[model samples]
Target: MTNDMRRDFANREELATYLKEQFPEAAERDDHISPIIGGRQAAVAALQKVDPVKYAKSRNFLTGAVTRLSPYIRYGVLGLREARDFAFSKIRNQDEAAKFVNELGWRDYWQRLYMKLGDGIWKDQEEYKTGYSASEYATELPQDIREGTTGLVCIDSFSRDLREIGYLHNHMRMWLAAYIVHWRRIRWQEGTKWFLEHLLDGDPASNNMSWQWVASTFSHKPYFFNRENLERYTEGVYCKKCPLYGKCDFEGSYEKLEAKLFPKGEFVQKDNSQSWQKGKRKR
Candidate 1:
């Protein structure tokens, strides 16, 4: 039999040095980033504290009571079935618990699709469903957005949150995706790659297709929101300090936004009455 092989670090400094050398991208994060406790015990502790009743009501808000169990689930330290059991045990009310369970279901849904598609998950599964061709979008994220210097205060803060902490609110993820895909006119693939690099919970399956959903590639319509929508959710924290203010990139309702951005007037309307069937069938 062959001898077992092993390597050991002399100290934390040596470990840090080795990690930096081998994985230059895994740099240190800000102190304010949410503290994570790994292992089964910590996952159990975190799960026990989840309030499904409150989560269903305020989960969309920035300060919402979300069960921060994503990293554990992503790493295999926790399993979906166990998490679901804990949720159900806490709240027998199916309606309130259903919302939380459904959110977890999305993770399973993404993984199943990922296995079915294999490598095809990385490539575009359909044409840009927004009535625009693939040729119209940028292949790479813009330098400004990558550098977190877009000058839109809220977006920049979100950018810093992503890169620094490797975490983001789900709504913020959609908001940024909508901005890049619809407003900046970048390809969803570009956004996906960028997000994958930083998101601690980033799974290629859910991440990429969700980006497509914002692009209307996987959904019936392109997802968009005006500044007012941002203000309502974030409680005007970023907008108040923002120079873009009311005149920031997203300025109008869907109709006006469509006229301003996709002036070709070929995009499907909100009601899904008009068919954008030119692309691959929506999954």
Candidate 2:
């Protein structure tokens, strides 16, 4: 079974004693650098240095404004509460501090949902009934999506960014997920697994749950994005650079794609069996 829950170390004193015995090398090292310590320190420093003003203004820029702390959280290097407290302690006002806190809450929610649902959350209900096949599709779609060869410029750029840095902007993740599910008709579980394999911040709870959320499996109504939303949110930054700006079928709009997938009031729900099939295929 994949362990997706976070663990607490009981107390700092006990944790220190255990680390001394279990990790002698780490204990002796003066710098004491690990995912948790490094992540907490990095978060604290970012909070102290940037605080409300910088984070508020530049968090969405996608270049370098946001704190890259997901790997630490994913690996249990840093506890969620510790990170939250550190940020709250640094910020003077509650309202401004809430922005960062809400982001952390999202992490907590993903984990909670995973614990509550377990593997059932990953299956697709429509596959068996509709005779939706995944094996042949999985072999091809993952390569095309990961290689950025799907002919979708924004998605390709996001894929390339993830391959190079194991990171993508928050907005880019949603856009990529939507395109992969609705436009490409690839299984979200397949896409989610591919991400976990490559992403430095591959937390099962967050990664899987977020993919389901985007695919609309968690909700009755599937969340779809269009060209206008992209243009407004991305500030038309992707318009000129995207390879599929006008030539491709989607044309960077989800309305047409949605109509095609769910014609005659038929909703395109995610198939959870895709997750298990993917696991078997990987083995």
Candidate 3:
């Protein structure tokens, strides 16, 4: 609670123990610490492994070759330009680094919007396109969701990973946000708060804007996913073992899900096809 708080610790474990002792309430909620190390050395080491070519190809999948450098970037241990420059160093040309660079550009865009919008970023940029009034959405996140006991295997797993590891695959983040806002009809701000509380890379601008994007308050349309799309990207790892495999909420085509989740909204069809699908053309 004081500026004179201890800064010296023998190791990460000691530091964690000290933090838990100082902040018992936080520990009670979840004592878990992320395995991702911090500091410039770790950031540089992570940056050294940047494979823009492979990242462009597999970044959407659950087990993709992601750089996992967001925490470093978020905390300023590594700079965005530094990461981009390093990625460029490994690539043959602009096309090879386009996807990776594009992602970095998105982060920059979000931050710029955050600076421009100020506190306005917390408010909806536009009325939600989901055809529901703001009053229709629940303001509080459900207890089951916060506890990671939703019983839907994929969702529960995502919730658990978020609470325990303080990170999620970008796809999982989108799916979870969509589920909370569109599927469960909870307000996106509630989900946004939860993500900020836990994500190691939780940049308020990026996190808030992303939830708004899913909620249709900051995008042309709301984003949702079907089981087939989820399974294809995640290699069916969660669906294959889920007790609700065939009967789960996500078990349907994009058209079917669209009708169900946003019944009152003008339906805009989103591509359900996986980006990594071989032999299938991008729509």
Give residue 86's error in model 2 in angstroms. 2.9
Q: On lDDT, who's better, 2 or 3?
A: 3
Candidate 2, superposed: residue stretches over 4 Å from native: 1-64, 124-142, 252-257, 266-283
TM-score of each model, paired residue for residue: 0.85, 0.67, 0.93
What TM-score quantifies how close candidate 1 is to the native fold?
Answer: 0.85
How large an RMSD does model 1 have?
A: 4.9
Ranking of candidates on TM-score, top first: 3, 1, 2
Residue ranges of candidate 3 with Cα displaced over 4 Å: 1-3, 272-283
**Candidate 2's residue-wise lDDT over 1-283, tens digit each?**
8944334677666655765777677456322322233445664554445354456556665553576667767767666787677767766777776766777887887777678878865775234211234442342356778778866676778787776666666767777877777666677888887777557777777777667665655544444566665566567777678756766554433446556655543554333212110111110
| RMSD of model 2 against the true structure | 10.7
lDDT of 3 by residue, 107-150 (tens): 88889888899999789888988889899999999989988889
Which is better, 1 or 3, measured by lDDT? 3
Winner by lDDT: 3
Give per-residue CA lDDT, model 1, range 162-270, as digits (tens). 8877888877888888889888999989999998888888888888778877787676557777777777777888888988876878777767877777776466435
Local distance difference test scores for all models: 0.75, 0.60, 0.84
Q: Which has the higher TM-score value, candidate number 1 or candidate number 2?
A: 1
lDDT score at residue 7, model 1, on the 0-100 scale? 52
Candidate 1 lDDT score at position 272: 21
Q: In model 3, what lDDT does residue 231 have?
A: 93
